[model samples]
Target: MGLGRLSALDPKEPVRRYQRERPGELLHLDIKRLARFEGVGHRITGNRRGASQGLGYDFLHVAIDDATRLVRPQDRRSHAMAGLVQPAPAAC
Candidate 1:
């Protein structure tokens, strides 16, 4: 890439650096919605008219420490569902 092409970008300043102190200093919670699959879908099973049914999604909660990049698997803090709160397995 040449400098002429790079000059077109807005705010051409360099990106800032970030650093954390300790392992448990900063943490971030993430909720990922995953679809519950019971059996083969219509596409896979070659049944075009077959309804997939009411296969709701499962919310996976994950807590990660930004500093050490260590995953702290815990529950009860982040529950995406409104009525019931459940903890997903740590396999994900």
Candidate 2:
């Protein structure tokens, strides 16, 4: 369908809107690794000689509400969440 026809149904509405009924109804969680070491790293200089062998990395833990887009970020030494606990929600 054309955009003109689509917009007519819900003017100024997003293409997709997640309906969150409650505080914990919908949430998003993710983990990402941010390189902690600085130097002529592996990718650019290549790992043929194990250039980044001793270098370590830090992990970024992130959470967000699908409804409000409120984000919480924390950095950790490791990415393993085996014993990690969920943080209490902040006051609205």
Candidate 3:
């Protein structure tokens, strides 16, 4: 279907941005998993010999305050729910 026809069939609501009044009023938490790598990759080495495999992944937990735009980031070896339950360390 054409873009114009699709929009007419299903109209989308107007986009709205929400902002917290206070610094601690709202916090957005997100987790990202990054692959673990050792030494240089084949892209640079031009060879796949001795490539590291099954090294596991690292999880990065990020928290952002809606009002103040403050960010808190934490790195963890695993992405377990238990790790999130615990408070992030004081040091970033």
Candidate 4:
């Protein structure tokens, strides 16, 4: 079998890109979880004593507009409540 025959065995799909004509036409939402800590950690304090325990996490909510490329980011305390929060007015 030749090298060309091997590549022809598995065909790949072409990549597609979509763009919105208006600012509010499309929006992408994302959530990121960040660790919560109190005071300085061992990296900064050089001591692991008095470490905080049971500290929860903070959720970062981000929204991006497809056309205008505008981004809105918000810090939330709970993931459950993150979805309940309302979106801010568009600056455009």
The sequence of per-residue lDDT tens digits that candidate 2 reaches over residues 1-92 is 55567556775756984567655456677888876665776677767575545566778877776656667676665434532225424422
Tell me which of candidates 1 and 3 scores higher on lDDT: 3
Question: Per-residue lDDT for 21-87 in model 3, tens only?
Answer: 8666677788899988888889998998888889998878887777777777766655454555344
Least well predicted 10-residue stretch by lDDT in candidate 2: 83-92
Top model by TM-score, which number?
A: 3
Q: Estimate, for each residue in 12-91, the C-alpha lDDT of model 1 and write its tens digit.
A: 68999775776555656677777776777776878867576788886666766667666645333453343121222222
Clashes of 2: 0
Rank ordering of all candidates by TM-score, starting from the highest: 3, 1, 4, 2
54 Cα displacement, candidate 3 (Å): 1.0
Give per-residue lDDT, candidate 2, residue 18: 59
The TM-score of predicted model 4 comes to: 0.62
Distance (Å) between predicted and true CA of 22, model 3? 1.2
Candidate 3, superposed: residue stretches over 4 Å from native: 1-15, 77-92
Stretch of 10 with least lDDT, candidate 3? 83-92
Model 2: pairs clashing at backbone N, Cα or C within 3 Å: none
